[model samples]
Target: MRTALRPHHLRWTGERDLAHAIYGTVVGTAAMATAGAHRTLGGTVATVLVTVAVYWVAERYADALAAAVRGPDRRARIGRALRQGWPTIEAACAPPVVLVAFVLVTGDLRAGVVVALAVSTVMLSALGHAAAKHAGATRLVAVGCATGSAVLGVVVILLKTFLH
Candidate 1:
């Protein structure tokens, strides 16, 4: 019997998907954070979901098309594309949960948006650190990776503050 692979044993596809997820997270967080003042918490969350879904679909379609050109089994290529693109959609899951929870508890949509952005920033930082460590990066390099991911989220939040 084969033992299950450990989380640390990441394949190239896992790394690629992680990168996609990080990109998606940044996009989704930015979309909601920079939304207009008239936007409600639910509307912002829905917008994020729809934006990520559209991105996910577009990525999968492109990937599938590329695979179709290289292979004979269209169904398998489509399935592979869908699986590969799933992490991007999954990346959008966490921030909205934080948003909804904070909004429900504090009854403040703006505060919820702040909390959600913060939570997603932290998550991205963690993911960057893990990815770097998994690739045998030095501790300093891992920290730098984490900081870079965090800065992406922070920049978006800063833009929201200034723009809205």
Candidate 2:
């Protein structure tokens, strides 16, 4: 694996990770919009699960890229993978947690919870990306995730308002 993992290869992997994150964000938003249209607790749960799955996949990609860059030292590779993946995991969890809290607090199984979760995902993604950048990860990848998440959030809101 180390023999195949050159610096350029790592760079390309990072770029791909960014692209995947962007694509995942867009798809997740669309899924959430559809879920919001149903206005049911089950739909909300499904949307959250879908979004979380997308985020989990993106994080896995990021971890793989980090591992590729970290080389053959297993301990170092594991550490780098964790460092790269943790922020994304946290960011992804924030939105669902907020949604659940809001649902429990307000007892309203409506589109508002989905909207709030989408917005929270964007905000948390931005903060997570910033932290990842500060920790020496690829800035472009972080920015891409953050920007994509924000755009998706806006699109979700628009779809919920106009289409749903």
Report the number of the highest-TM-score candidate: 1
Give the candidate number with the greatest lDDT. Answer: 1
Q: Where is model 2 poorest over a 10-residue stretch in terms of lDDT? A: 7-16
Report the lDDT tens digits of candidate 2 across residue range 114-142: 65646655663664465456457687887
Clash total of candidate 2: 0
Output the worst ten-in-a-row residue range by lDDT, candidate 1. 1-10
How many angstroms is residue 129 displaced in model 2 relative to the true structure, after the best TM-score fit? 11
RMSD of each: 3.6, 9.8
Q: Considering only N, C-alpha and C atoms within 3 Å, which residue pairs clash in candidate 1?
A: none
Local distance difference test, candidate 2: 0.57
TM-score of each: 0.87, 0.50
Residues 1-164 of candidate 1 have per-residue lDDT tens digits of 13224232243235676687788888888888766464687788888898888888888889888888885787887778777856576677789988888988888998889888998899789778877886889999999999999998899889889987
Q: How close is candidate 1 to the true structure, as a TM-score?
A: 0.87
